[model samples]
Target: MTGWNADSIPDQHGRIAVVTGANSGLGLVTAAELARHGAHVVLAVRNTAAGAEAARRIGGDVEVRELDLARLDSVHAFATGLVSDHPVVDLLVNNAGVVLLGPRRTSADGFELQFATNMLGHFALTGLLLGALAAAPEARVVSLSSITHKSAHLDFDDLMSERGYRAPSAYGRSKLATTVFGVELDRRLRAARSPVISVLAHPGLTRTNLTPRAWEHRGRLGRVVARLGLLATQPVEQGTLPQLRAATAPGVRGGQFFGPAGLFETRGRVTEARLSREAADPAVGERLWAAAEELTGVSYL
Candidate 1:
């Protein structure tokens, strides 16, 4: 729907939702909308203060919990605490991510920061929380991807970007991996006759702090671009539509990719978008799945 808004969200009373990086940007908007619809939302964030403020701003039954997607230990701890507190999770939104700047930087576990936080950490957290998710009547996992994924290539040999580093390419690769994982997870869930739905979505060029913070240290030119881009970009609330649709729409199916229907899939109304050749590659997906499991030491199947 071209004019889709958060008001269209279905009633989510008694539902439980976990949104990563819900403190700001698209994640914040997503969490707020869910809470508005009567769902008990858990804001999984790295910054406790900001997350608490976001929860307060949402003005609902929102709970702020500590979660650092850049660290495996933090992911594990968050999962454990969530499981203990809430036995079933109706929705899990893998929305936390990072777009690194300049040279290569490694995560706590020595993996590429973008890949580690955007893909591996979510993988581990989802795997660890699968039980809670499956316990719900109709659980769903919405993986946040991006339009940039179409131009991405997964360099298996140099997955950590140790060979070379380009910020945009690295970010794109991580998002592509996330999309592939969503598709593969759907396949496995169907094959195993599971009760969970794995869906993917992208916020087409929404104005957010991600870009500015990512390119913050890149000098005056970078700052100018960030400022101008924000002015030209759609609001974060509108940008979250595709994701909210994928997570809660009645017609949304497993393995479907959603994005803005506007110009070049960059800005406009939410719709079912086409997948790239790389995203639909089963062999590549399986390979990535195996590699991810090996890297994170967490397996869903």
Candidate 2:
């Protein structure tokens, strides 16, 4: 799809959307745009203060809700609250994630930081919200992956980075798991004959606070490197194209992946991007899905 832009997003009237990490970056832009198109957008973020600011900026039917993905308790509370208020969710964009950070950190649940926050949290969120998603006539779940996923491989024995951890490697592996889960969820939904759909999208290289924040704890050199890389990346607005397309584009199929079309998919019009053979491996996806169930204690069809 050449020349694809936000203008292509159809009217989202009467639809309800839940966007995680919508306080900033790609998630924020996506939520704002969806709200502009008349969708009742909920900004599910960890920091209620930041989320409120984000909602104020968007200025629509957007509401801020506390959702700390790293903590299973917070995840459950958020999901339960959302279900009670809105029985049906037309769109669930699992877009919140952490970037490559220095050293190994543990989530509130004691799992590796990247894998827990980026992959596991989203996994549980989707599963817990399955009922709400299925209640909608035609629901769509869009999971955000990354180009780095191409270089990642899942190591079940060390899913939590117990053996060793490299910042970039951990980030890639987490993203790979997210991509696999997205695809696997679609297959399960199809097998169950559900109207819900799952699709994946990548932001490519975009100028967001993720890299800067992740590298902040690494000292001066890390910040310098991150800033240099950001200079060559596209704006958050352009970076959000693929996911928005995956969320609303017509004729979009479950399991399809979308990304940029130019310069190794770093920046350009939205188009179908490539997925690594490893990411397409059904065994890996299935095993990861099972492991996620074990870790998050959340499961779905």
Candidate 3:
């Protein structure tokens, strides 16, 4: 098959898309491009001011809603509002996530911050939005994974890194959980014969505010490196290709993963990404799903 790029995006007129973390970085670019292609995009972000700025910058049929993924109540409210306003959502992009923090912090619900925000929150959001997604003629749920997942493992006992926590380790585990959840969700959706499909993608080492912000809490040197990384790495527009392809590309299938085609999947054309043995394991996914449900009190097949 031919390689996929932003130009490969099919006509998305009449589609309704909800992109988490659309205020900046990869999410912002994804939302802007989708709106450019005629999809009515909703920027579900934590900061309304930033989201409004993003909407203005994107300058299309775009709307902004407040959503802090670290809080389950906020997730429920966002989904409920969407379901009432837009009955049928054609695309739901689970792209909001956080990376490396200085110390272990707990969310409003008391779960580990990274795990709660990156994995559990999206899982709950997907389930809450499942009804609207399935109501569409054919809806797709695209979860953003990471290349970091390749080096991670799910320590069930330390799922939240409660026993001990390292910034990179915690972040890796959270991303691995996200990728595995996407695969598992696809399996369940297929088994249930639901019209909704789950797809996963990673932005190959794109320079985004996330890394620098991760270090911002530390000091000036960390922030400077992040700024330099953006200039040195792939552009945010290119970084969004994988998720956009997964969400809108023609002939795309559930459970398939996409990422950059360059060295180590860091930056290049969009193509099927490699999954680690740990990420591809269904048993592990199932167990993680159960744990996620228990943690968030949100359940779905």
Question: Residues 193-214, candidate 3, lDDT per residue (tens digit)?
Answer: 9999999999988888788677
1 versus 3: better TM-score goes to: 1
Candidate 2 regions with alpha-carbon error over 4 angstroms: 216-220
Per-structure clash totals for the candidates: 0, 0, 0
Model 3: lDDT to the true structure? 0.92
Cα RMSD for predicted model 1: 1.1
Candidate 1 segments whose C-alpha is farther than 4 A from its true place: none
Off by over 4 Å in 3: 1-3, 216-232
Which structure is stronger by lDDT: 1 or 3? Answer: 3
Candidate 2: deviation at residue 90, Å?
0.3
Weakest lDDT window of 10 consecutive positions for candidate 1: 209-218
Query: Candidate 2's residue-wise lDDT over 1-301, tens digit each?
Result: 6878898899999999999999999999999999988899999999999999999999989889999999999999999999999999999999999876567889989999889988999999999999999999989999999999998989899998877788789999999999999989999999999999999999889989888777666789978987888888999999999999999999999999999899998888899999889888889889998999999999777
Candidate 1: deviation at residue 61, Å?
A: 0.5
- Candidate 2: Cα lDDT at 160: 88
lDDT of 3 at 72: 94
